[model samples]
Target: MLIVFGLMIAGGALLGGEGDSADNKSDTSAATKSGSSSDSKLKDNYHVGSVANHKGYKFKVNKVTYYDGSDFDKPKKGNRYVICNVTIKNDTDKKQSYNPMDFQLNANGNSTNMMEILTKENYSQNTLDSGDLDPGASVTGNLIGQANKNANLKLEYQPSVWNDETVKVSLY
Candidate 1:
């Protein structure tokens, strides 16, 4: 009886160990498959009102508006405010962070972050803010930047800090 019990314990450990390794392998493979599939779906350029997916988040640049700035808060000479009304939806099972800083304006070989100064404007309440989004949650707001008045502008969204993949949106 004791011999049978010892053998049963040994067999269980071997089976359990193998099962765990199999589970780990499957998890890794699944992640790889999903990542590859999503990467393939990424496009070269997106336009206003178009949807772009990054990882598990859905982003849309709903509208782009230009501001010459108010009396007290004027843009630099030859520069104007570029405001993108963006919407981000968290499709992942876990919570994610959404910030205006993640959006950048690219023009004339220069990349600039959101213009935080506009956040102090009276219309600032409509500007984007850094916040946490739970699964299925969404946030929509403006990302304000300053760029040359006549420069061709492009907006880039870097969704993940771990990866350098970006979603580009043309603002013609």
Candidate 2:
């Protein structure tokens, strides 16, 4: 009877140890899969009219328009203006500065940035006020990007230019 009891204890310990090792392997694989998906989520684009809260500001994409550049005076030989109208709200009590320069327009596999230099008409009608954002203040305007055509478009906005954290808003 004592021998049988000893055998039972030894078998139980061995089986328990193997089960733990299997659980650990599964846990590791699960964590790895989640980690990979989370990285892609960071670059994922929020839908139009969806609000994204990052750091202290709230951002939303209102509308997108494709122009011949005749209205904005930013037309190249073949390039056109894919203007994204976005609303940025400051939720924090303190003032903040938002430069639309860091954001980019992603269409399919193509990408374009907010042009730093713009003609008076394009700059005035579409540019956001980059001044100190007052508490509870919100500014809405167009962000111009030169694109061949608007297709599967999204706006990639980085609340902090220094970090990889970005919120993408669908423009189409």
Candidate 3:
């Protein structure tokens, strides 16, 4: 009985050795509610409203809203606003600076950075570069993008300027 129990415990440790632990939490069920795991640059994939974390920084997307320029009579007829209410947490020892430009919106395999328009005054609200983030600091704001259909929109974040690895999140 002792040998059998030891084997079982060893098996458990081997099974959980990957990045699925609580501290290194990974949502590896993208198809289901469990979320999905990372594949190299694509760290973790969340289903729309779930929080996605990478390299200690936690990102939570609160809401996604699209506005048609027709009512406001601002943008062209074909252009629409894709706004994402997002929150960023700085889990670093040194102060960090996040530029809204560092974020990208991927739709239909095409990627675009934050929108730059003259009419909209609050395009990059509460974004990463809003201020210097102290350790454990979190900032939330609305990031805008101009696209026709906001479906299959994924939010891509590169926490550090030194590396190309990104935390790709699905904002479904």
Deviation in angstroms for 26 in model 3?
Answer: 29
Q: Which stretches of candidate 1 lie above 4 Å from their native place? A: 1-35, 38-40, 119-122
Local accuracy of candidate 2 as per-residue lDDT tens digits, 1-172: 9999999999999999999999999999999986765643443568888877654578888877677655557566667677778888888877877877768887786777875345666545667646667889888887877766636777888766225677877766
- lDDT tens string, model 1, 1-172? 9999999999999999999999999999999987787754668889999998766778899999888887776888999888888999998898998778788999876999985466455457788888999999999988888899999899999867326678889998
lDDT of 2 at 83: 72
lDDT of each: 0.84, 0.73, 0.66
Candidate 3: tens digits of C-alpha lDDT, residues 7-59: 99998887777535643543334333323223323445665577765545577
* Candidate 2 lDDT trough over 10 residues, lowest sum: 36-45
Q: State model 3's lDDT.
A: 0.66
Model 2 scores a C-alpha lDDT of: 0.73
- Give the least accurate 10-residue stretch of model 3, judged by summed lDDT: 32-41
Of the two candidates 1 and 2, the one with more favorable TM-score, higher being better, is 1
Which of the predicted structures, 1 or 2, would earn the higher lDDT when compared with the native? 1
- The positional error of residue 109 in candidate 2, measured at the CA in angstroms, is 3.0
User: Model 2 reaches what TM-score against the true structure?
Assistant: 0.62
